[model samples]
Target: MHPLPAILIDGLRATLFRHPRVSATTVGAGMFVAVVVVYLFASILLEMAGTSPPWMLLPGGVLTVLGDSMLTLIAAWLLAVLAARREAVWGIATVLLAATVAAAVVVHWPLGELASYLVLHEHAGLAILVELVARCWWFFVLLVFAHWLAPRGLGHALGSAVLAYAVSAAAWWWLPQSPLVRTMPVVQATAEPTSGDQDGDAKTATEQDEADDDDAPGAKSEFDAEAAMYAQPALLDAALARLKPQTPGKVDLYVVAFAGDAQQDVFRNEAEYVETLFAQRFGAAGRTVVLENNAATVTTRPLASWTNLQRTLATIARTMDPAEDVLLLYFTTHGSDDHQLLVDLDPLPLNQIGPDDIADALKTTPAMRWKVIVVNACYSGGFVDALRDDSTMVMTSARADRTSFGCGADSDITYFGKAFLAEALNRTTSLREAFDLARTSVDAWETADQKDAKPDAKGVAGVEPIQHSEPQIATSASIEAKLAAWRRTLHESAAVPFAPAGEAMSRGASPSPDASTRSGKG
Candidate 1:
């Protein structure tokens, strides 16, 4: 062999075997460098494809990386202590730095793929288990390393691994808090006006919506004043008084657009579309009522608030025949980790709605026999445990621990809303069927989005699986039968055509005189 080749082979052998003359520091530094090189290469490759690195989170991505590195160092130190190793602090630090970089590189691709898979499927528990395996792979390596360095007994390795995991998990849960402020990319509106009746009644509704948009400029300045009026007790009472049930029907949907500050436009638009869709399909003209919180795109509408919601339910309950009619309530808003639905409208802070609040409202409405509730927000699955009963069917956008996606100022609807309301409902009349289709669509979209945004080479890193947002549904045993019956009656009514509910087309003008009168009688 050539002299240069022989020298390189000897050097590698010494480094791998931890030769007496070669300090642990030198070996650790080399490993650390190797990890950094891998991470940088992955980042560069991703960037070249017009994709941002997985660490580009809001508030401070650099800080998050630093936090991860710190956890690695702590774990390494714990392992050293458990193994009775007296390695230099600097050598240990270098080893940890290498471990952190290696872990980041090792974890990304799998995480992204798992996230994509989660979006397509409903097996969140399994996905999370796999993710834990990926995340803790470094610890597994560290265990073997502890034995290699110190030749300690199996007990030492196991103890070190257990302690390292406990400490690292605690630190991860508590540290690395990031603020929620991110720049939203603008997306052009893709939804078009819906098609309607032969007499052009649908055209009238579409034109009215367009007219409302055209009138936005004048209404912008008056938003504050109008918002204040909505806040007043007297104005709210008057609006509530004006609300009467329309003709008796098997089903009624009461929409509450819980406007939170995070993405006012997205929440508002989705809520409006859902109300219109439900009204048109389930005999909404007189039977459906919407209480909005934000000025949204249509400034002419009134803002809905917590107080307004309670009152609306009360009024609806008084007018509705509890035993014969069904109530479908849709809540669209932002959510917090504490499982509270955030209600916002700057200059006027509102209370967050918890599962208790929803339960209380329902309890007050003793007359509404059957209930179908849809919660569109992050951490909304927390509501299912409290709201689901023998007569109620509760559906949520995400699990209690996960955050749902697509609630941005530039977007029109959330992932859940788009899948369930806008798309699935258009294709099916059954709520159960709509939910199934929507969930599947959401999963495909999420998986595809991650794949398109982040393509990997040699599968080093995949897209960041920042959110799981596992949607959930809990239907009461007998509620399905009732819902089926309601659907039958709903379609038999001839008030509205089986048009795609809430398509961009005209929804027509206000409620007709006949609808209003029937509402009054109820």
Candidate 2:
């Protein structure tokens, strides 16, 4: 063979037979197969339901296959982007996936329903295949896209796609069914009444009479009156007595209470107590911005939104030195695994305000010399983990595995809030001291009551306590002085310099001492 032809052949072999490229192509092909399987299975289910016309089903199948292919492609693109550390591409792919899923769910409701029913019927062969396809197709798509787009060529794409597929499959298999699915209605046959039911009816009537007695006016009045007494101003006063310092305005305080939902009344009672405590000790006059029973306001608006509470904090920060010693944050609400401080709205993703995100936000805010964030909620300790910073002190009502407790149509203030307010009102204890005491007491209560329900009570007990993790009150003076000096330097450096003669005039420079001296002489 000629030398040039032999060289060309060798180069072609090296390029075409590369492991990475072959792997990527293989993964992409696999994803295509998976998607085709899902579509066919879904189509068969729809046909069985008699809802799909043969001709219409064909087009539906095509669209489903096409949609799945796009999803796979997008997934492959994402995998590749992630592998290459291409943030923009990854973000775009994520958003695209979310949008596509949302749209497909809306557009193919009937198809999903049919597929769901088929799976529910426990058709092992069809269900297993469909699930496998649904789970694996996205990985292949991502691999193919990555291979096409990634700078490292096919190998990187293939590796990433395979990894993503494994992860998706594992998650799909392990994840619990959605709440809706778990609560699905089971059909049952109705039974006819018999003559023997008369005895049962007589007993029911007697039970109803007893229930009415339990709900009589006197009994209801006594319960309501006692609840009102517990929620009275005196209880708040006691709470403040515990939380208050000897000097007023010595510490800046922020209280965020999320009530409403089905648990408004309970929360309302707690809110009232907390407010009263602050009022008595801190002089409720200007210290508090109570978000009274407003779960919607807290959850719906982003933290950056111009909520009344946010506005108040901004004003306070503006008025005080950025480095002033101040206790900055207090939050009481429901929390979820996703790290969302859930209130009235559905749980938000924890990623939205992860500990790192909270740290970043606090770093920029100039108002507080020291930041103290207290979260009273189920799984609230997770917030502490996310919000911890050199400048922050964190406290949570419960650990990540536990639930905060209280009952009253979900309206009563939670046990965590109640304990917290009680300690705060004492006035002798500092914020740090109060949080420690609260955590200890709450944990003890949860442990004692829920010992048998260990898993269920995982988060009920607050754990991993840290006292004065950031700048404590003792070091506040020195930190404040240093901050002041830095601020002065910043201001001095930022001052515009004076220029001379025509140069100064043209540039609109302010007059300097030297210029004034020369002008006076002239």
Candidate 3:
């Protein structure tokens, strides 16, 4: 063996055999060093990938890594302290032997699966299991060592492990929110498109197409919407045919329902309800589109894949007088830690949507100057950082590290969607006001849930302390003025009646004049 390797092995052996008292200071230093090294390596790999945005490379990225390192060190130090306490009662040899056995057990643990579950936030039962283990696995290892060192029975070891795990988890939960991970404000002066910029005659072409569609020889008498909502060129042409020229200064509304399979029914329900609400409020019955993947009979058009979504958005952008229209896009789905919003309707493959996907699409449609984007999913706050711009307002259900609740199949709406879209929008005319009210409602709901949470052997039942979703909102300065103008228009329009008590909107309704109606095309 090389001299350095031999020396390192000898040192380890000596430390094990001598059973030296491991001071808290020594353990703290070692853990801190290890954590820093691990995070440093991770940051290097991130840089090498060239995938991180510019913001991440500087203060944001650096801060995130530091926060992560601190979290890791905190967990490690807690375990070390427990191990030391046990060693004091027995001897170092027992602690070392126990650590070896614990290492073996940990090696057999399903860590990879747990990590996947955390990112995807699917399979609720599995999520609970993963959360339980992830939060306390370190304590479990330390407990094994403690048990051996102190000659404690398994029951005593379990109790001590739980207690230690709880304290450490509480500490982590109480840590101040990291400044590294924060919302970036959009600089309106630089980001907004100039008025004099003219791209092409696309707007004129769309107007002509809409005028021609009003005299169609034949059109579908009613919408026979199907499961696959992909845009065939012919279908798209037909759909765009009936759009009329947009009225000057009209704030037309367009909705996109991005659904994932995890909470299919809930997503579909919210999409349908919002479509109805907007149709009535904006006189935009034909403008809204529901692209969903539930196994339902034919209420919603099927969004076959990511291509369909992109095509639909492009069509809407092209058909509408983007300069005068306001697009209200509602995306409800699961979210990944990698900043992807999940889009699925199983067996058929669907591409996941990332923050860049949305930003890129918006960039392509500079004519649609005003946007209200609501992302109803876990970890959605990550989207705000990427999607924020002078003409857009972004609201997300939860911060990047949190998961929103009430997305199960049995639920009617996600906590954010219900509060922001269904209830607040109806009660208040202002989008920003709705957002404020929705955020407060969500916070109260989460607080109540957390208060009732009780951890068991598996995890908390009916509630989770760490699963509280912290909703986020980001708006550009320019959008605030635009939104205020839109609010006035909304209030002036003939308002839709609230849904009758104990009932939401009907599941199905007859189709509208044309998809371009929101743009006043036909």
Candidate 3 collision pairs: 210-243, 227-302, 229-302, 243-521, 244-521, 244-522, 322-367
Residues 401-437 of candidate 2 have per-residue lDDT tens digits of 4445652232244666655665533633245556556
Error of 3 at 442 (Å): 0.7
The TM-score measured for candidate 1 stands at 0.50
lDDT of 3 by residue, 462-495 (tens): 4324445778889877778766776666645544
Which candidate number would show the highest lDDT if scored against the true structure? 1
Q: List the candidate 2 regions with Cα displacement exceeding 4 Å.
A: 1-263, 295-309, 345-367, 407-411, 451-522
In model 1, the worst 10-residue window by lDDT is 513-522
> Regarding TM-score, does 1 or 2 come out ahead?
1
Superposition TM-score, candidate 2 onto the true structure:
0.35
Clashes of each: 17, 37, 7
Candidate 1 structure quality by residue, lDDT tens digits, 361-432:
564312355788988876688889988877789999877766677764445677788888777887778899
Q: All models: lDDT? A: 0.54, 0.38, 0.51
